[model samples]
Target: MIRLLEEMEQERRRMNELGQALLEQSIPLSEHDELLALSQKVDQLMMQLHYAKVEQTERQYVRGGTNFEAPSMV
Candidate 1:
């Protein structure tokens, strides 16, 4: 899961670079549409990546928290 998150981040950076490149010149109509779609996909993946990290933290907490128990009464 960590590896997957890292890969997604890399892809997001690549796409952002492409978006920036497009801004430096006048691109074709088709390229403009493709850039828009890719941008949306990058945004969606960022949200998913955030949730994945949150879930991972929650799971780790749950797994570690089971080691303690209450004492018995006399």
Candidate 2:
């Protein structure tokens, strides 16, 4: 999880740099394939991070046990 967070941050920084370069040159953002690809990669990493956190939480609950009980559906 820590490694994934670091990688995601690195990719986010690269994407920001690419965006700044495009803005400085007055180039259309849509024309940069690398920037778009980076954006998608960052998005994927974010989802992965979210899922990892959720999985970790579930594991903790399973290991320690939760106090709250499920409500009866009746």
Candidate 3:
């Protein structure tokens, strides 16, 4: 799990690099496809990290049940 987080962190760094390149106008139009692909990969990793953190927190919620409840329909 720690290894996974480390890898995700590295991927996030790469994503930032791509985004910065785009901002700096260093990336070519031909590379947009690859940049978009990397962006999606970064999104996926972020979601994974988010889910893991949530799961870890839920394990220590302290209460007997859930911490969130869906809004009730009228």
- Model 2, stretches more than 4 Å misplaced? 65-74
1 or 2, greater by lDDT: 2
RMSD to the hidden true structure, all candidates = 7.6, 4.8, 5.9
* Residue 8 in candidate 3, Cα distance off native in Å: 2.1
Q: Write the per-residue lDDT of candidate 2 for residues 1-74, one digit (tens) a residue.
A: 99999999999999999999999999999988999999999999999999999998898899986556788899
lDDT of 2 at 40: 98
**Candidate 1 lDDT trough over 10 residues, lowest sum:** 22-31
Question: Quick one: how many clashes does candidate 1 have?
Answer: 0
Candidate 2 TM-score versus the reference: 0.83
Clash pairs, model 2 backbone: none
Residue 64, candidate 3: how far off, in angstroms?
7.9
Q: List the residue pairs that clash in candidate 3.
A: none
How many steric clashes does model 2 contain? 0
- TM-score leader: 2
Give the Å shift of residue 58 in candidate 2: 0.7
